[model samples]
Target: MGLYPDDIEAQASAIITTYRDRGWLIATAESCTGGLIAGALTEIAGSSAVVDRGFVTYTNQAKMDLIGVSAATLDAFGAVSKETALQMAHGALMRSGAEVAVAVTGIAGPGGGSAEKPVGLVHLALKTRSGLVDHREMRYGEIGRDQVRLATVRTALEMLAAAAQTPA
Candidate 1:
């Protein structure tokens, strides 16, 4: 069986605790995974200190309007591309005043898949004062939409934890 949301919540709790101990704050910019990353972090009590905020920018327009993702980036790289993901992470950091930020965008669909980008394709980006980190993941193609989202959330939380460790 796949991991549950609560399990992801627990992981996020650990992440928040670690970051809080080190005096860091985090923000999230989400697309296909919605606010699952932020929701997982907030699920833990006293997450306010570590979790600055979360932005659920599910649409291209929202990404631009809410997070300052440029229209040029979106047009040049598409919403799911690493370029857009990096821009989203940078935008979240700029808007949320967090020490670190994580962004996720992808085609999590049973319907939106194409030959180049499949249904389970996910792109994650992490931004810190030092630099940006990015990852592209393709989860098991057979899993349903819910499972794909869950996988993305877990990966995002893990990335957040890793990003929190970076010196700001």
Candidate 2:
């Protein structure tokens, strides 16, 4: 089974097709979604033509090591913070051949809820090789664990589609 919910398959396919049509490769950096964004894209048959790679940085160390996220950013704002998401997006773009990179980080859980950063609090970022960066903060509320993750994947896919529409 693909990580993408059935409702999102068409969107993912469309984005992948658009990227391929434009000769643009895509990369993803995932944390709470656990690479579902990449999984969704790869589900399309022609994804290999547009999907460069995906970085699954579940742990803070992995984010720093794989995506070159700065220790200072993580320390100052935590993993789910926008600062970290920006770094993750940029890091993925820097490390990959893809021209556009999308990143997601959040707490998708029945646990891990704090007053400030509760469950379903996700941060997403998209960056292009031409130095365009967009960041979105999502508060999906305390929906069920599965629901939160699915919602995050949905949002990321939509953002990916929008990012693909932008000129590289």
Top TM-score prediction, candidate number: 2
Regions of candidate 2 where Cα sits further than 4 Å from its true position:
1-3
Candidate 1 lDDT over 1-168, as tens digits, reads 123456786788799889899888898999988898887788788899898989999999999999999999988888988888889999998898787889999887878877777888888888886675656555546477888888988888888777766666
lDDT (tens digit, per residue) of candidate 2 on 62-163: 999999999999999999999999999999999999999999999998999799999989999999998788999999998888888889888888888888
| Model 2 whole-model lDDT (C-alpha atoms) | 0.91
lDDT score of residue 135 within candidate 1: 62
Q: Which residue pairs clash within candidate 2?
A: none
Model 1: lowest-lDDT 10 consecutive positions: 1-10
10 residues in a row with least lDDT, candidate 2: 1-10
